[model samples]
Target: MFRTVQDFIEDYRDESQNTLKLLNLLTDESLKSANTPGFRSLGHLAWHLVHDDAGMLRRIGLDFKAPPAGAEPPESAAAIAAAYRETAESMLEAASRWSDEKLLESHNMFGRNWQNGLTLLMFVKHEVHHRGQLTVLMRQAGLQTAGVYGPTKEEWEKMGMTAPK
Candidate 1:
């Protein structure tokens, strides 16, 4: 968990860039791909990441507002990337208004009080988890996967490098 607001902001900036790269690899057709019918599509997953960050901020008594209710998921990869960037910017801006003490203060989330730092960390982890899933789904749907933490499998092959040890 983050202890200082600066730590959260820096980490968020890095993670958000990675997310944007991943989104860039999506295709319009791939947005509808999912493991099964009724499961969340790639577009849905991306949209959720955008809204959920704002929701977590709200749960911590912040003024962050989620995307509009029933907003249709964007099919275009460009749109998804743009939305993620916008949300990340808003999150950082909101965080900038808080002090380190405020970040460490307790806030209620899901009926339990947690330090705001912890809640924010949880939100970041949650986004990463879903994003990892989306990357695999993207491959299965025949879309290219962009390098996030490091080079993706296909990327490594293209560079004449085997998977990292």
Candidate 2:
């Protein structure tokens, strides 16, 4: 969990950028990619990350510009990516107003009382989880996925390094 607002902001900035990188790579056709029938599509996962952040942040009195919860994913990939970018900036702005003490305070989240800091942590983790799912769908859609932590296999190959098996 974050102990200071700056710590979370710094991490959130990097993570949100990584998400944007992946989002930008998506094509309208790729958005329909999914592992199986009736499963969540790549577009749905991406939009969920965008909208759900608003709901979670609002719980801690942090409001960002985002689509309402349960909003349908847009058909245009560019629109989805643009919305994510906008919300990321908006969220950072709201979080910047918080002091470290505010982070430590308790907030009602998902039927449980949670430290605001923990909620921030969980929100990032939730995004990361769906991001992993997106990479798989991107691959299925014949797109080269970007690396969030390090280089992706395609990136490594471009760098003249053999990717791990």
Candidate 3:
């Protein structure tokens, strides 16, 4: 969990950017992909990340605004990516007003009382979880996925190397 607002901000900035890269790579066609018949489509996962962050941050007392729950995914990938960018900036901007102590203060969110720092971390983890799902679905949709932490398999092969297990 974050101890300092700056620490969280720096991490959030990086994570959000990496997430946005994957979002930007999304195509309208690939958005329909899911791991199975009863699973969430890639667009749903992506839009959930964009909208759910608002609720998570608001619960942490950030006063951020994102799309309402159950909002339909935009018809275009660029629109979805743009919304994500806008909301992410708003969330960080609101979080910037918090002091370290405020950030660390415990609060009840999602039926649990935890420090705001942990809640922030949870929000990051939630997005990351869905981001991983989207990457898999993207590959299933015949889209080349970008590597979040290292070179993608395609990139690795291009370099005459293999991906680490």
lDDT of 2 at 23: 96
Please tell me which predicted candidate would have the highest TM-score against the true structure: 2
lDDT of 1 by residue, 55-148 (tens): 6678776564456646888878788778778878887888888999987788778888889999989888998998898888887898888888
Clashing pairs in 3: none
Off by over 4 Å in 1: none
- Judge candidate 1 against the unseen true structure and give its global Cα lDDT, from 0 to 1: 0.82
lDDT of each: 0.82, 0.89, 0.85
List ranges where model 3 is wrong by over 4 Å: none
Across residues 60-143, which tens digit of lDDT does each residue of candidate 3 receive?
678876888778988778889999999989888988888999876888886888898998898888888888888888888888
TM-score attained by model 3: 0.92
lDDT of 3 at 14: 97
In terms of TM-score, how similar is model 1 to the real structure?
0.90
| Steric clash count of candidate 1 | 0
Angstrom error of the Cα, residue 140, model 1: value is 1.0
Q: Write the per-residue lDDT of candidate 2 for residues 136-164, one digit (tens) a residue.
A: 88988899999989999999999999999
Q: What TM-score, over all chains together, does every model reach? A: 0.90, 0.94, 0.92
